[model samples]
Target: MKAKVGMEVSWHLRMLLFISFASSFLNVSYAQTNNDYDTPAAPPPGLSNCNGVFLTYSFTSRDKEYPHIKNATAQAWAFKSSATIVNTGEYEVKAWQMFVGFQHKETLVSATGATIVDSDDFPVDASNGTTFAGGSQADLKTSIETAGDFTQISAQIDITGTQFGVKPPGVPMPSIIKLVNNGYKCPKATMRGSYNY
Candidate 1:
């Protein structure tokens, strides 16, 4: 009778240990699933042009985990710009050029000291208008900034474009081209204001 009781107790303890281990594994899996990365937000408003072309610029930064770095979280920033151009004119446009500029500022704070990094006038080109129709959809450009580790990061992006219609073979270039504006400036405007993270 004593031997049977000892065997039953041992079996129960093993079963309990197995159940505990399984439960812990399930809880960890659930937490990881719930903490998936988030999608980026939409670009700000007022980044359109007078010629029915819309430009959007967005910046995002987040904390990332690095297993190799102890007691340190990596900070990363991403920048993107997209342009949608609609001819909306009576005549088809021959060519177009989109100009984009970006600036990034970063500050790092650690036990030693604080370090700052500034980058200005980084140019990105996204120009294409080989054959544009009156109501056709066109993508002008897309660009992404580098990511790194910093305590604070901020960025500014500017976008502008010029459209050119079909000109006679002998006509000068500038005379046949049209400049697009967004009420703020002529042929140039702010696609995205200063964004901080």
Candidate 2:
């Protein structure tokens, strides 16, 4: 008779615990509904918003190499701006990294002004705390970052000298930005930036 009584008490306690959990979840959902009211509409097709972010580029590159695109264009989409505006404000619109250009034998060209010839794929480390959803801008940046940059032409490359260690790969010629930026009025050649995410 005592064991039966104990079991009944245990069952009641379990039922009470379940009811408590359900009530807690319900209150949380109710509270969050208030926060949702102030949230802006999801970013429109092009003119959009990142969650909790009014407007901003996760990363920006103001390289010294490509003078033309250096600080040429920014990447924050303005609110109420055109949906087609992927980049805006003040930013440098240099060519895409070479390895992201003609170098990678396969894969669609990244964007307009991208250098496809010397492009190479750079795999990001998911375990290294850099998170990237496939096809996101972050993914594209990874590909560009892995590509060797076009700067500081080593003497060994110019003369095939012994100083060249194992003949580090050379940046491709006819690269859209490097060539143009190099000869631009201010004469900048290559520029690069990295995103921590």
lDDT of each: 0.31, 0.25
**Runs in model 2 lying further than 4 Å from the true structure:** 36-88, 91-197
TM-score each candidate: 0.27, 0.21
* Candidate 2 root-mean-square deviation in Å: 18.7
The best candidate by lDDT is: 1
Q: How close is candidate 1 to the true structure, as a TM-score?
A: 0.27
List the lowest-lDDT window of 10 residues for candidate 1: 108-117
* Cα lDDT of model 2 by residue, 10-110, tens digit: 99999999999999999988998877677764432322222211111112211122222323222111111000112221222233111111121212212
Show model 1 residue runs off by greater than 4 Å.
1-29, 32-39, 45-53, 57-97, 101-188, 191-197
> Residue 148 of candidate 2: its Cα lDDT?
23
Clashing pairs in 1: none
Evaluated against the true structure, the overall lDDT of model 2 is 0.25
